[model samples]
Target chain A: QQQVKQSPQSLIVQKGGIPIINCAYENTAFDYFPWYQQFPGKGPALLIAIRPDVSEKKEGRFTISFNKSAKQFSLHIMDSQPGDSATYFCAANPNNTDKLIFGTGTRLQVFP
Target chain B: IAGITQAPTSQILAAGRRMTLRCTQDMRHNAMYWYRQDLGLGLRLIHYSNTAGTTGKGEVPDGYSVSRANTDDFPLTLASAVPSQTSVYFCASSDSSTGFDTQYFGPGTRLTVL
Candidate 1:
């Protein structure tokens, strides 16, 4: 079973617009949530992360809104740009485990 | 710092043949992991090592094996390759001292089984 589920396999947005990607996980033991960004033919890189204790975290134009009770979290890109176009993946780490459960991924495209 | 490096950027293997994917890190991290990325499936952990001598299986460890002889290298071996084993594999490492830290990923190794 997929531990983490992500919606909208792909997304498209115009420059300066906001692109939102959402993810849901089934395991309540998960305490750490992180987002990764990957370009074509490259490995995924850490974009931002959040702990369940906080409701939200913002880094530059990237923001992560987490709802521990709802078991859902979302990533929002403010002032999206074409350079921001890439595949985004949401991941959850079960407490005390060294492994991370990743979402299917969302391919985001920003049009100039 | 060459966080991590994977060998054989891409490879093609015959069914039933044996193959090994190599991963190395220079960060001296205590934790290393191997993951396979497939279309629509995202990344799934195959195996991981918490320290130099100990290893553990992850979500998809069937038909695969791994060894961590030291802190820097973790190799994944496929006793016999199958069509289903063809996928992009990635290696990652993190500092275990930190409760939960970001994992640094290697470029990737794409393998094709025919």
Candidate 2:
């Protein structure tokens, strides 16, 4: 129940394309969902996040579409650039919990 | 300010050896976490501390231990390393005081056990 399953272990896209990454979880207690982007030799950084209270949240060119009933969420990168190429991870934190359960990760490569 | 810092960018250790990964955050966040990242496995929480002087075990805490002596430092220790323990470790911090859900991560420590 703690696992957050993510699909498309790896993805490739051309520049100016939109790349989507999906994640699902079995735990209904999770209230906070966040996506993290990690570059080579760097730590994961918060790209965008959304709560179950809202269906979607957008930040700049990154957006998080959340589905409460389906226990799923996804990250969509608009006009993806080569700089966006990195490992993306989706994480969930149960209500009032301090720890987050993260997905395995998806390696995205945006080619120019 | 250095958000979070970890020591020993990478290490190759022999099995059955003891090791400790150092973590420090200058953000003065009250909560800190330790996670291990392996290819196809993502990041797994090993331990966490909501505040100084208090700590808790996480999902993969069996082979590891953690200490939170102060707000800025949290260290993870391995009593006896094994080949399976090889992975990239990350330290993260969040400011629970303000109800901030964002976790700032460190660069990560890559450990290889043989």
Worst 10 residues of 2 chain A by lDDT: A26-35
How close is every model to the real structure, measured as TM-score? 0.98, 0.97
Model 2 residue A82 distance off true place after TM-score fit, in angstroms? 0.9
Worst 10 residues of 1 chain B by lDDT: B95-104
Task: Score each candidate by Cα lDDT.
Answer: 0.94, 0.92
DockQ, structure candidate 2? 0.86
Question: How would you encode candidate 1's per-residue C-alpha lDDT over B1-114 as one tens digit per residue?
Answer: 898999989999999999999999999999999999998999999999999999999989999999999999999999999999999999999996778789999999999999
Instruction: Estimate, for each residue in A12-74, the C-alpha lDDT of model 2 and write its tens digit.
Output: 999999999999998458878989999988999988888889999999999999988899899
Worst 10 residues of 1 chain A by lDDT: A25-34
Native contact fraction, candidates in order: 0.77, 0.90
Q: Tens-digit lDDT track for model 1 on A1-112?
A: 8989998899999999999999999955898999999998888999999999999999999999999889999999999999999999999999997778999999999999
Span of ten consecutive residues with least summed lDDT in model 2 chain B: B95-104
Report the number of the highest-lDDT candidate.
1
Itemize residue pairs with steric clashes in candidate 2.
none
